[model samples]
Target chain A: MDIINNLVKNLGDGIAAGIYGALGQGLAADILIMVIAAIAVFAVASGGFAGLTYAERKIVARIQDRVGPNQAGPYGILQPIADAVKLFTKEDTTPAEADFWVYNLAPIIVAVFATLTFTVVPFAPGVVGTNLNIGAFYIIAIGSASTIAILMAGWGSNNKYSLLGAFRTVAQLVGYEVPMLLNMLPVIMLTGSMSLVDIIERQAGWNGSWGLPFIVILPLSGLAFLISGIAEAGRSPFDLLEAESEIVAGFHVEYSGMKFGLIMMGEYMNALGVAVMFSVLFLGGYAGPILPPYLWLVLKAFGVFLVLMWLRGTLPRVRIDQLLNMNWKFFVPLSVVNLILVMILGKVFVSDPALFKANGGILIQPLAQALIMGASSFVLLMIALAIVTRRVRKDRMAEARILLQRRETNQQIAASVH
Target chain B: MRTDYAFIGVTLVVACALIGVVPILNYLIAPQTPNKSKRETYECGMETVGDTWVQFRAQYYLFALIFVLFDVGGVLLFPFAVAYNSVNLWGVIVVSLFVLTLLASLGYAIKKGALNWE
Candidate 1:
């Protein structure tokens, strides 16, 4: 019984130790363990991608009042496998004038970077592929690098639509990234550490119960992060990068077969990455009772992904200008202010030792602090919403006035001519 | 820390190898019969007109510049955030001032119509 529980709890560590013991604890054993862990992460991410696609299709189909794929092996369970076989067998195409090397290298870059991000994501306690001190920063850096691969695909394609899509990529991805990074600051501040494991541990209440997640204290930043995360993943309403109606499949316009398959894999992998990160950052990570830690983490991540799919089904894609405007004009400013507010609140309520003593209990301190911060942030959100509503109303009224003036002038000109 | 990074490096190599091998295998298995019409750039069945690498608007460069500015600022602020608990009120003041400076730059950019889509 003891061995079984230990095996269930420390599965990854047990495997590493088993390999080490088998290989006499040498450097080769270390290298082999790392390689195996990497492969495991890749498997998990790709499997998540496959399942995400099927879930997205079914959810979106139901949203549109239709039955989704049901033919392939019991309610379309094998649909992704069938799709994979078809993509593998299809003929790959490269445009005659395309840059041969960069065009071919782009998909590999996308897949590699997407897979690399899973390195720092802690699945369960001590189950991370790596425990980098700058885990959060590493994720941001790797994510930004994928932008280069996208640009390479677009420019190397040598097609007009691809170039347009590439330009939109710069405008949208770079624009929303500012807000995303800014919003992350508050969570880092509250935790006082950049290691994702530390951040998760910081959220635990007394006795390791599921404590108040960061979302409760910093709702504004959490909301901003979600919006920016969706944009970062290039999903709907912010998917100006590959708005199919506008740019005919965007950056990968010229890619065919497995190359296109690789790009799609990168995209779905990114969506899964974002969902997992959101869970780790704001959903108390793998912290739950009764169920195993990794299972809790997976459940939370799937919940977030379901929300993403819901939005993808429900929302219409915004125009490029509107997308950029929302990022810069709305989210960026809101996040910056929220960061400052959170900084002050953290210093006063969270970081102060006196407050902890005064509160007289571990749970009370966090609860009180959360209440204060949450209330303040809710007020800030209300004010910002009111201001935005006023500005939008004013703009609409002014545009209506201009149209009325134009119509009246046309009527006057017609009367004069008569 | 070093061992962790070594693991990351190995994972990176493995990820590259895993992704790279698929296309190679596909190349071996998948048929490749290229024709002139098939290899041409797709333009919705219309003849290609004008160069694809035409001059893009300068607005893209402007956005990139602003992004770089904020991105660097965020990187600089990260250390302060991590050290926030250990630092004093003076530290808070200094960080606040730094943020104020960033906000000032954003205001200047807004005033100059740098963010205007038109």
Candidate 2:
């Protein structure tokens, strides 16, 4: 295990060296290295889908107290391979009225966009692809393409269900994106950098070597981000795009053979990409004790993914109206407020030169600031809960009163008639 | 930066090729026996009705427009947020007022029931 860990840690350097040797060092080497990195990222994104499928099945099975996919080679680890082979061998079909160009292009767009997000995710200290200046917004910009891709699939399929599914997807994904972007505002404010690597570095320890992750400082922001991001990634509870019971496989209903496999690959890759982003933004990417950097990142991302599978197993899918309402009415408002609160609180307390310098850069004040933010957020949540419950109770009481009054009036009329 | 674009361009082209190649591989392996009924648009074993391109509700357009408004506004916020620490207090105030406007618009939208489902 230790040897494997060491080997994994050195893999990036080994690949870089190999590229340099092949291309000769300098500008040419840099470009060639990037090409190699891109291919590696693509492979990881596509292959990660198979691993995610296995992980999701096993985790959900464990949640339900049942074994899953154990028949196909050692606890079904090879199940995805078998599934892939089956898909490859299955008959490919196109609907008579389908728009062939758009139909063919949609899955390609989805897959490419999904892989593109991997460019910005920092697995370790030096293991990032490009770390572009606009790293944060780049993810959002690239992610929006999935909406277009799904629209293409739906419209091009010439299936009513697919079109309806595509519309729902656009509505849901777009709605959730607002809150997701808003939720990241606080993280950016605190870190003072849009780069993922910078965010992680800023989150490193104030006094001691151990860091306080962004989630510790702004739990409300983290919570909001994760919820909306899950919806953005089209996971369960927001899996309206492929709501099997309702839409008959949804936007990709007409897709078959390897095309269908490509769509599924896109789905899982998007989820994995989001999970990596979650870790980078909130959990302090590549910052942990004892473990290798990439290993820490993988473990943290896997932890997030496990939570996603747990959510899939425990929660039922929400109605489309309910999904939109949650995004717009609840999450959007809450995220806005949370962002404002963090910006204000962070500016006044945590970033103040007087308090921070007076304390000689001790970690105590940062911890105190985090506690204050957490306490205030909790108070706000409780107050909101109280107001909502009171409103619901009043509505229910009024409804009951109306029912009773109607019954009395009916009884009086009956007596008078008699 | 130019190199970064090169990387992205290569990745995209390769990814597209990979997606295309998979289906071609399947085409080579899989049998093709297309029939008239098999080629018809799928409607859960039912015959074709009217055209499948039905117009969606206007609400979707409303959401998309709202999303565009907020998303573009949010993109503008990222620059200010990243430069927050180095900037002066007036810079903070300016951005705060900007965010306040966004919040006010959202609140107005909610009060007008733009987000209501019913």
Candidate 3:
């Protein structure tokens, strides 16, 4: 019974111990364990990608009031497998004038970088593939590098639409990346660590209960991060990079067969990475009651993924101009202000050792501090919302005036003609 | 720290191998029915016009510039953020001033209409 209960908790350590025992604690054993861990993370990420695709299709289908993929296997559960087989067997095509090497290499780069992000993520206590000190920063760096791959796909395709898509990718991805980086600061400030595991550990309450998630404290940063994350993953309404109507499949327009599949896989993997990162950073990763820790992490990640799909199903893609404007004019400024606010709040409430110790230990002190921070962030959000609302209303009035003027001129022309 | 990074290095190599192998497998299994039209650049069923290396608008450069500034700034702030608890009031003040400078730059960019998509 204890083994079953502790099985998921100590699974990683157990595997490592078993390998060491078998191999007599040599360097070979360490290397073997690392390789095994890598493969395991790769497998989980790939499996999550496949499941995400199926879930997205089903959820979007239901949103559209249609039955989706009932034929593949038991409610189209095996649809991703069928899709994979079909893609693998399809004709691979490359344009004659395309940059042959880079065209072929971009998707591989995408797939590799997308999968690499899974390394620092903590699935359970003591179950990370690698607990890098700079895990959070490492993720951002990897995400930015993947942008270069998309640019390669676009430039190498030798297609106008692909080039256009690549341009939009730079504008959208880079613009949103600022706010995304900025939003992460508040969490880091409160937790005083950049490692995801440390952040998670910081959220544990006294007596091992669930402590206050950062989202409760820094709602503004959480909201900002989620929006920017959606854009970074290229989901709607921020998916201007590959808006099919405008750019015709964006950066990977020239890819065919499994190369295209690889890019698609990379994208879903990225979405999963973002979802998992959000859960780890803000949702008190792997910390919940009455369930395996890893299972809790997975559940939170899926919840985030479903929310992404819901947004995809409902929101229309924003125009490129609207997208960039929203990022620069709104999110960037908001995130900057949110970060400063959080820094000041942290200094005021959490800096004093005496005050921190006096309050009911780890859980209660942070909770009190977070309550104040949360209220301030809520007020900041409202102020920002009011400003945006006023700006939008003013723009609409000017637009209405122009339309009315145009209509009157047409009416006057009609009267003169009559 | 070294061992942890070794895990990452191993995972990276494995991930590369896994992703690299798939395309090779596709090449082996997938059909090769190459033809003139099939290999042509897709332009919505029309002949390809100008070169794909058309000059893009300069507006994208401005966003790139802003991104670089903010990205570097954010990275600089990370260490400060992580060490926020142990730092004295002066540290917090210095970081606030740094953030204020960033915000000032953003404001200048907005005023100059660098963010305008047009």
**Tens digit of per-residue lDDT, candidate 3, span B11-116:** 8899999999998999999989899999999989999987888788998898899888998998898898887777755677788898889889988999999888
What lDDT does candidate 1 reach at residue A18?
A: 95
The candidate 2 chain A region of ten consecutive residues with least summed lDDT is A355-364
Every model's DockQ: 0.65, 0.60, 0.70
lDDT of 1 by residue, A272-368 (tens): 8899889888888887666777888899999999899889888999877678777777777788788888777666655345644543223235667
Error of 2 at A326 (Å): 1.3
Q: If scored against the real structure, what TM-score would every candidate get?
A: 0.94, 0.90, 0.95
Q: Given the true complex, what DockQ would model 3 score?
A: 0.70
Comparison by DockQ, 2 against 3, better one: 3
lDDT (tens digit, per residue) of candidate 2 on A202-258: 777632565888887777778888888899989998899889999998999999998
Q: Pick the candidate with the highest TM-score.
A: 3
DockQ, Cα level, model 1: 0.65
On a 0 to 100 scale, what is the lDDT of residue A298 in model 1? 92
Candidate 1 lDDT at A342 equals 77
Better of 2 and 3 by lDDT: 3
Question: Cα RMSDs of all predictions?
Answer: 3.1, 4.2, 2.6
Q: Tens digit of lDDT per residue, candidate 3, span A1-418?
A: 4465467557778888999889988889989988988999999999999998999999999997889888998999999999999999988899999998889999999999999999999887777888888989999999988899999999999999999999999888988899999999888877778998998988765223647688888889888998899999888888777878887888888898899999999999999999999998888888877777878999999999989989988888777878888888899888888887887676666634564654322334555777888999999999999999999899889989999999999999999999
Off by over 4 Å in 3: A206-210, A351-364, A404-418
| CAPRI-style docking class of model 3 based on DockQ | medium
